[model samples]
Target chain A: MDIQAYISSGILEAYLAGELNEQEMLEVDRVATEYNEVRIELDALRESLLKYAQVESKAPRQEVLDGALKSIQEIEKEKFFEVLDDEPEVRIQRVNIVPVWTIAATILLFLSLGFNYVFYSQFKNTKDQLAALQSDQTSLANRVSETNEQLQYAELRIAHFMSEDNIHIRMDGLDLAPESFANVFWNKKSNAVFISVDNLPEPPHGHQYQLWAIKPGVAPIDAGIFDHNQLVQELKIVRGNVEAFAVTLEKEGGSPIATVDKTFVKGFLKKS
Target chain B: MTPTIESKISHLLAERNKEAIELVFTHYGSLLLNIINRVLRDDEMSEDVLQSVLLKIWQNGHNFDSSKGSLFTWLVRVSKNAAIDKTRTKDYRLSQESKNGVEVVSIAESISTGDEIEKLYAKQLIAQLPGDQKVLINMSFFEGYSHKEICENLGIPLGTVKTRIRTAIKHLRSII
Candidate 1:
């Protein structure tokens, strides 16, 4: 490179004036760094410009420095707060819409989050209320089923007692339970026996009332155990002729043989 | 100032020492104010801009790279740019446009009206340069006008504008 030609090209003056583009500036920087004469010439130009500006120098008032110091203190305070907050400062650029849009988007995001939380709480509450309603509905359905079952049992007992073929025998209470009595309904054709206890004493825990059917000159046969609380209960069938019906206190399941001392009630069927 | 003292001041500025601001005001504040004043041509606004420019230097002092240019060159560039930006404002333009011929004439006449004898002599020294060179220097250096702007404003080719600036700076270098 011709050093003198490069110096006279006027690029250094443009560089000093800061009028060159970045690429041109870098090129000038490279040339000035590589060549000693170029650097000296550039420095001389900068000095001349500095001296030219100095010729017109005028001192500012002391108040200006005071104002500058106050401004610097304010800047330092803002920087300190920025450090404490650990949030980057929002720099607003003139003639640009992006920063305004950024602030809007941030506010919208927070609002969306708040709305999401509210909806989630409402959804959870609604779900819990729905579950509670479903439980109530299920309990109501169970109660209706129980009432239906009781109605069905009452209808069956009424139909049994209204039948003409059923023979009802009254069983008187013995000495073990003098106040207790029971009525037995025996279907003539089917030989099905249903016993309805009027006032039977509550049996001990693990003890229940068992009914027996006795035929002439035959041993008493086990009919079935029944809950004293039951108004009407069906017992085992006696296919042959039944001479008498009796109830005895026994264990949970009926024993094969009836205990004589534990008998609570006994009744003889009218000879038909 | 010695390169040693300049390097020390650069280090202090980079470290953000408060003393560096004081030193900057004492050393280069007037020079920078003059750079700003050339563009503004108003004492109050120029003084205000000079304070702001000082604050800007302190805030961005670490960005100054000595390898690019002298600190004084960088300061001049910063002050000139700030002043130029101020002139681009609507308020400045409106004020300039609304000013009567008398105010404009007074502003022009006030450029040479200073108290110091050396300042008067320096003003004459710049006036002693050839008219074309003087105008190029004033437009390019003091006014912060670009080569392209100078070409468009003066109706000269861009090359001629740059060559004249170079020739003018070389002439000022010899005389000043």
Candidate 2:
């Protein structure tokens, strides 16, 4: 056979697809056996066509298989009866006076049904297992995100405290109160103080803890009212080069001037 | 135990082994369905024909020679033939061309649910073929139209249809 011409004709594609007539099929198969290229090319076409078909394929319902099996049984029953009614020579030749093909088909049919059941069950179990794993993964991801958020918050706090531009101010008790103390975290650039009322005594009713920023020979500036009862502001904003810091008990709102008699705890920003 | 399932599966199937038959059905059931559905274009009829095709594959398992082609290719050839046979029926041809006046959607959309459709070796390979080339393949392989019939339907010469199909498949040899 002129293999190249036969291949170029594209009839082999049709042939491998079983589209060729009997004569053409024989010719193609004969050449395919004789020539390696023809066989390989023919096979490749088969692979391509099947791969294409496989992609577009969908399974009929399991009932389709079950129904098919039942139909096979019906077919076998008819075949058995027809054989019993005719072909006496065939019956005598074969053992049990029955067509062995029918029995073999019946056994294969039953085996196939059993195999189908096993596959379907296995498929369901695998699907269920996959679903469970997916849900487990989702919950683990959520938990990881929650932990990440907390770690981020702690990191932010650590960064804020360790910032190079911040000044820590520790206030000791004045002569009237020896044990009272408090601390302030002042960011010099921002002119803001984060105050901690560590050991200051609770103020009397109708009075509040007031914070002050003082300069040498200058009157105190009312920084902010730090009323434990009525204030939620933890950081007080103040400005200027302060020589001293002080806290005093003031009236419910605040005092325009310092009432030094009620001075409780104080601290000055240490010079760097 | 070959690195690829192809050889091991081919071995199983060539022996008329039950496992091979089951494996083939599990793997290529949708493929057979898709090929038939593409040809028949009717779900119910396609399924009936699909069952029949599967039976033919099973009954004639010994006749299948794997050295010539992989089991999948043989199964595909069987499926396409079965589908094309259904198309040749008068009732099927009439319902398809006359009753269903709408231009059919792509084969990809019809076999919508299967995992195989996701891979769409069919869509990628055939869709890449220029418009007429793809149509020519489908008309011949899926619709069971002969080269003459395809040429007549498309009003092209016989040699054009034949050569186009040949080249298109030859092109796929490289791509696949």
Candidate 3:
């Protein structure tokens, strides 16, 4: 490289003026390092420019520099004091566990209270339900007693007719109506019989059950008429020796005598 | 100042020495103010720029490379740049233009060198350039303006302005 030619190319002036782009500046920096003449030229250029700028230079006030220095010093002092302030307090309070333990206890107490509140509320609800169920049971028992009293009143009404001497015939269901059962309590003196169809279910609609008093030598007699609602009925009893009792379906009201094919229940009583 | 004094200044800046800082205030404070006053020509703003420059030097002295330039050059660059930046702001320029006629003679005289008579004479030789070249050198050196700004301000092409300033410096270098 022609070092003198490089120095005379006006590049040093550009470098001194800070006019060179970064690439050019780097190149100039390299050349200045490699060649002593280039370095001297660059320095001379910078010094000359510095001298020119110094001639036109405007100096600042003393108060400004003083104020800036003072502020920086104050900032440094504040930082030092802050570090000092933090150190002792941190050391003294480092081992204190009271606040941590207090927080833990507070959390535990809250959880315990919450559990107790939930359990107490549930217990209260269960107690209230139990009291309500007890009341319901008492009312149901009272209803059952009332129904029993009504049943006794019906038995008393039937006993009035039954006190007289009458044929007391029991009816056992036959194979055709195996589940059907009835009893005939007859008073021979009053000629009245109370039919308790206790074990018989209600007959189907448009059908009536007829009762008969049967003697082996005679034809069956129409004792009385009964419907489904008449689970127990007071019927006018026939004044005769009844060898056996039988029930059959006739028309809706009943027939003069029982139809033998339609017998749903039958029984016989022994003479006492 | 010797290398020892320079290193001591660097060390004091590193340690953030208050007394050293006060000494800076007592010595170079007025010099910085005078430089800022010429560029900005406003006492208050000059003071502000000087403060900014001193604070910068205090904070960044560890990064200063003496091989690149003298500490004085760095200080001058910082103060000049601060003052120029202040002048570029709308408020400073508007106020400065309005208060343009007020001659800041005392600040200029104080900044005029008596300690380095030969160096001051060398600087004066460069100042004898034509008004346009003089302005270009000031803008480039004192205010840190680019070649582009000098061209725009002086109504010359960028290449021509660069060449002219280079020629001006070459002439100044020969005479000095």
DockQ versus reference, model 2: 0.15
lDDT of 2 at B21: 49
Tell me the tens digit of each residue's lDDT in model 1 across B53-112.
878888888999988866656777788788888999887787777765766465344333
Instruction: Order the numbered candidates by DockQ, best leading.
Output: 1, 3, 2
Candidate 2's C-alpha runs over 4 A off are A55-272, B1-16, B22-44, B60-128
Ten residues in a row with the worst lDDT in model 2 chain A?
Answer: A227-236
> Residue by residue across A55-169, what tens digits does model 2's lDDT show?
4443455655665556656766798989877777665677553557888889999999999999999999999999999999999998899889868865754565578866777
- List, residue by residue over A1-272, the lDDT tens digit for candidate 3: 98877776677766655555545666776676677677667666655654444454433334565688787888788999999899878866764566778889999999999999999999999999998998898898888888889878777755754565545667878777788788888776676777888666567777788888888799998888876466668876677677887888777887886689988888878857
Indicate the docking level reached by candidate 2: incorrect
Fnat of candidate 3 is 0.46
| Candidate 3 second chain TM | 0.52
Report the backbone clash tally of model 1: 0
Root-mean-square deviation of candidate 3: 18.9
Q: What residue pairs clash in candidate 1, if any at all?
A: none
